[model samples]
Target chain A: MIRMRDLRKDFSVRVPAGRLRREKRLVSAVDGVSLTIEPGEMVGYIGPNGAGKSTTLKMLTGVLSPTSGEVSVFGLTPVPQRTRLALRIGVVFGQRSQLWWDLPLRESFRLLRHVYQVPPAEHEQRLRRCREMLDLDAFLDTPVRQLSLGQRMRGEITAALLHGPKVLFLDEPTIGLDVVSKQAVRSFLAELGATGAVTVVLTTHDLADIERLCDRLVVIDHGRVVHDGTIEALHARYGSRRSLVVDLDSPLPAGFVLPGTSVAGVEADGHRVTFALDETSAAAAVAGLVAVASVRDLSVVEPDIEDVVARLYRAG
Target chain B: MAETGETWAGETWAGGTRAGAIRAYAALVGGKWRSMLSYRASFAAELLSNVGATVLDVTTVFVLFRATATVGGFTLAEAILMTGLTAFGFVLADLTVGNIDDLKRYVRTGQLDTMLTRPLPVLPQLVFTDLPLRKLLRLVFGAAVYGVALAVNDVPWTAGRVLLAAVAPLGAGLFFGAIFVLTASFAFWWVESGEIGNGFTYGGRDFTSYPITVYAHWFRDLFAYALGFGFVSYQPALALLGRADPLGLPAWAGFVAPLVALPAVAVATLAWRTGIRHYRSTGS
Candidate 1:
């Protein structure tokens, strides 16, 4: 539902040397990156601090015009018809809220209804659905500023989706939420994607959010998309090394050597041994360790999404 | 989610256009009024403080006028009229355009991103977001003080003059609002120095309160021709008081207050569009 082509956003920043002596330096926030988001696909855009993920999302949502490229949302250029594009897209900034602060949640929703020109019946239906899904009935009458962060985030998400946007751009939507709240938000997004009505692009540092909600991943670093594929594909590509931790009842054998297995480290008392295996079967590695020592307890440590993305960055 | 709950019942709601703009304005004013009502004690104290400060300011002007008796061929009474008229215009500007000063803060902190994504124009939305009801009290206080001063001076008040005097404040408000827009538009390029542009906006009002004749010829020309601030207070009050035009403006120019506001607003709007473009290019 969204397409970006050779997008490049360059900023001319003044290099301040003194009051009278300064020069302009061009910095590219997003450099020659392009991607397409299909309908009902929840894609996670991951990157380090200044990797231009937020810039890319802003261009797609009509909030920022790309400097030297084109962004089309559902076949319309976002820059040329921003107001009309606003109707079809919804955005939520995790750090900021669009709701009126002093007003009650219901009042904010009503104001949004008027602003979006939502029909009365559809507005009512949407409110009902949103309240049920976001669990907003508990504090619907409370002022938004008085709400807890989790509750306020729920309100923000509800407000963004109230217009039934064809696409939703969530910038760090689950940041700073508690564990339960994060899971709730992630599950809600998963259910929304399951409905197949809207495309979702989530930019967040939280790896669990990606693992829980997004099936496809786009890893960007230094203003470029370094990797783009399914979660399993990313894991398979950069997540081959596995760590094996074995707790032995007795000390390891002297000069023990297992084929394709190297000792990573030895913990206290030399009873716990850690091994790094390269493209080796987990069962075979366990058997090799068991054969060399009396195993008490053992576990395989598979790399999570965080380690995989971190590895990609480190490799780059 | 209650079906029977209804807020903003009688307020007219619109997102754009002149009529719709008026409706949105009223809604904003109503919202501010309700907020002020919620803190009655604080509101009363704020009103009293405003009155005290205004009285002190007027007393200073009165003392100066008693000493000089006339300035630039304007008698003490004419000077009072000019002062009162300018004060009224200044307060009206504050009431209407005060939010524009806050616009830079919003933009710098990424609050403007929320505003831009909304369905309404960013300008009108920011205006409606905060109405500044305290300044509205100042507006009433200014008009009342001006009315009393005009009565005490025994200036002949015709219906046309009264209408022009009334409309002058609104025109001045729009003029100041346009300046604020122009100032806030600088945030796109000079993000950290948004407040530097405020020197022109608030400083222009300070220069308008006194007769423009007192300043040097270059400064007077700057305010009149370059800034067009003289049309905001000086010319309108001159026409209302049956005085000769200052700055050699045409005698009938006061009737074109709305037209004068049109170009300032148009230019400010263009500047704002350009600023948004720059912001998009810069991406922060």
Candidate 2:
């Protein structure tokens, strides 16, 4: 379990004052943020640039001491009890490579086994699982520096899980991955989450990653939590409408009326129409559309989480 | 794989034991050694160049001696003994604890945060991860010079002299190790302060390369006496050579090299702990 109460972190930065002098100014990176994350919950921590997301993660992982307030990860104070807490937590920073740059991927894993002091049996079991799940066999012998970004990201996630940490913190795990690689990573994390063993808190700009993997989303802006709920709740909070589009075999009449829906847009001449569903379900809108027009194909598009989050940031 | 509750029941969340820590260090150091060897040509070049650098230091002493009978009231043999002792200590520290100078880069690059996440002491992890195995040959060369210096300086066969000769190098290594750590700790407060530490570590090595009498009174007093670089080699060499201090220090001061190292080590440890607390992780 992770619990933080009114956590705050401030950094003192030096700025030029005049021709021959400099001044120190205190900047609040994280201010009055409070949260509680239960075990086995995969939460997406999202924010704009410099939103104190990384700072909060650092404080949670014991890398940075909080300037004020409280933090408890697995019932231990992160800073004073860092070594003790480290045994149960794993961190992956996508922008950085934790593996030895010159050694083969397998060598880094083997070294980490000793670094974490895992029993050989458990280590081998976890390695086998990661190797199979993450498809790491092909590049196991290749030096980390030679691996592609996608391959290296897989290796990094594998390395973090070898010790079976109770909590996993990933910062932008899919930041630079290509489409195929991103899907591979998302599916792997989805399966990992299905096991309900590790509590995952990940921060990323990729809403697709969040939409596919996270059941809960926590959005912060300018060092404060502006929204914390499910994605559908976020859509409702922002009044973002869900739209249903239909491809009709024939164009609807100029005075055609579909009840409980409004025309969001018309595309592909009059053969296609997008209906913004009101408080009614997509089924009701589809039935109303079928009754009114000869529908060939139709699909419902949920409210864009990205736009809702953008509005959340603007409000914050 | 199935999610097994038994795995969690069997999990050991206890902190690693001392034996486990040792295994961790060995594993980290061994990984570094293999990584270094992967670039065969660079490894070979670094080893040779490291030895060459030590040879240059010894050659400079010899070249200076050719111009004068004695430097600051010490014969060439005695000066060489001081040089050998300084080299032995500095090289030992350099080979083991010297890479700490990269703390600035680690902080700037956010590598230190990665290290802090590991369930081990950060210092040992940093030292072992980049252990300078290539410097092993240079340490051997420094020891050889110390051996030759002892042979050239006769009258160093007494029981106390034998013990001093045996332990002084180790003392100097500890002293220099302290200096390296103390200076590297400055990075936590000032990330751009890289070369500032070299002034104390390498600067102290150069200062104690000759007899303290060769330096001006205030200069010698500052680095040699006040900072205790004198005890690293100069005073210890005096004890081994059975010589008196020209500056009127007690004879037993030479025997207290190890004693001097203890306080320096303590101060360095304190500085390192305080610095770690002040570490403000770099923004992502």
Candidate 3:
């Protein structure tokens, strides 16, 4: 449904090249990226900050025109036929909202009903479904600024879907949400995936979001796509070992071992420890850590896509 | 419904193409209407400020005409008419596009980001999103002041004169609106240029509030030809008052006020498109 050919986006920025003088410099935001997304495919376009993920999304949305290369979505050039393409695509920028901050959430939805030109009956049906699916009824009359981030994001998702867009582009949709809110978003997306009509392109820092929502993963760094395949393929290429970080109350003796887990690294001070464990044994490693030392605090660091991608970059 | 997620990519709207866009514009306008309702205090304050500015403009004219019976061939009555017309232009421009200063805010706050993603054209959407209904109050008050000035002037009101006077304000408004749009479009390339609109938009409008011939020859030439402010408000008023324009412009130039305004609208639109093509999301 979406296709790109040598997609390159360059931004010309002015920098002081000499004293009392500045020169325009062209910086490549997305360089030589060739990608194709099929209909109903949930793809995670993941990257670190300034990794050109947002740039790629902007180009796809036709918000930013590429300096060189071609990009077409649903057989339409996004920049040339942007308005038409917009009717078929919905976008949610998680850090920002498209909802009217002052208006009630329902009013915002009604406004979108016009913006997207959904029929009244269909709009009401979508609103009812959105309210129920996203649990938005409690705050439908509340002003958007008053709604919690979780509720607002759910509202945003509802707003995006009201027109029944064929392609949904989500940028960091799960950022800054509580556990339950994250679960709500993940499950909503999971259900959407089950619907099989919406193709989602999600760009996020949260690998768990990628894991839960996306079947295919595309990783970009420094304006280039480093990996494009299944998450397992990325893992196979760059070792998807989950890590457990624990603050020990005391130093561990040398050669301390936990069965089925390897101490990935131990701080010189011996208070902080990291363990690499299999997906299943990650829970067991934590349980075994209680025996090894008094745990101060611990967290299951998500699949280290960044570290893996960093390694892949170095190796390349 | 029939398995929600697996729809085809090539889906078209069931309704007519323009139906959605037209409805969307209405919704946007209605939403803004309600939002503005919540700012009654600010709205009132803005109305007072408009009235205050008009009072000050009239005071300045009275003070100038006090020193001399006539300033640059404009008697007190004609000068008042000029001030009234310019006030109308100011109200018109501000009502339509005063939020040009807010263009950078839209870009910085990422408002424009989401706006571009919509299926609507960005410029029209921005206009709808930032419609200055508050300024309409200023327009109403300005119209009242304009009506009073027309009455006080006791100017001969032929059908052609009244018709020309009535449409002349719209011409100035269109031209000034184009100025506002053009200045705001500069923010896409140079964000700092956002406030630079004050020069042409305010300065030009203020200059038109009195006789153009009062200014020195160089200044008049600069504003009249270089900036086209003469054709905007002054020329129409000149034609109405039966006075030849400064700088040898024919009196009939006033009838073609849209000629001045249309080219400006065209330029503003072109600048806006160029700006859109160059728009880089804030902070890269």
List native contact recovery per candidate, as a fraction of 1.
0.22, 0.56, 0.58
Give the C-alpha lDDT of model 1.
0.76
DockQ of each: 0.24, 0.57, 0.38
Clashes of each: 0, 0, 11
Ranking by DockQ: 2, 3, 1
Candidate 3 structure lDDT: 0.81
Which one is best on DockQ? 2
lDDT of 2 by residue, A218-292 (tens): 998888998888998888878889899999998999987777888988988888899888777899888877887
> Clashing pairs in model 1?
none
Error of 1 at B78 (Å): 2.0
Error of 1 at B185 (Å): 2.5
Cα lDDT tens digits, model 2, B98-137, are 8999999998888899899999989999999989888989
lDDT of each: 0.76, 0.89, 0.81
Candidate 1 lDDT over A1-316, as tens digits, reads 6888899987777798889988889988899898988887899999998889988887887778888977898787876667667777889988878887777878777777666766577677767877877799999999887998999999999898776677789999988999878877888788777676767899999888888888889999878899988888987787457788889898887898867778888997888888888757778888877776789998988766787788889876
Instruction: Using lDDT as the measure, name the better of candidate 2 and candidate 3.
Output: 2
RMSD of each: 4.9, 2.6, 5.1
Error of 2 at B16 (Å): 1.3
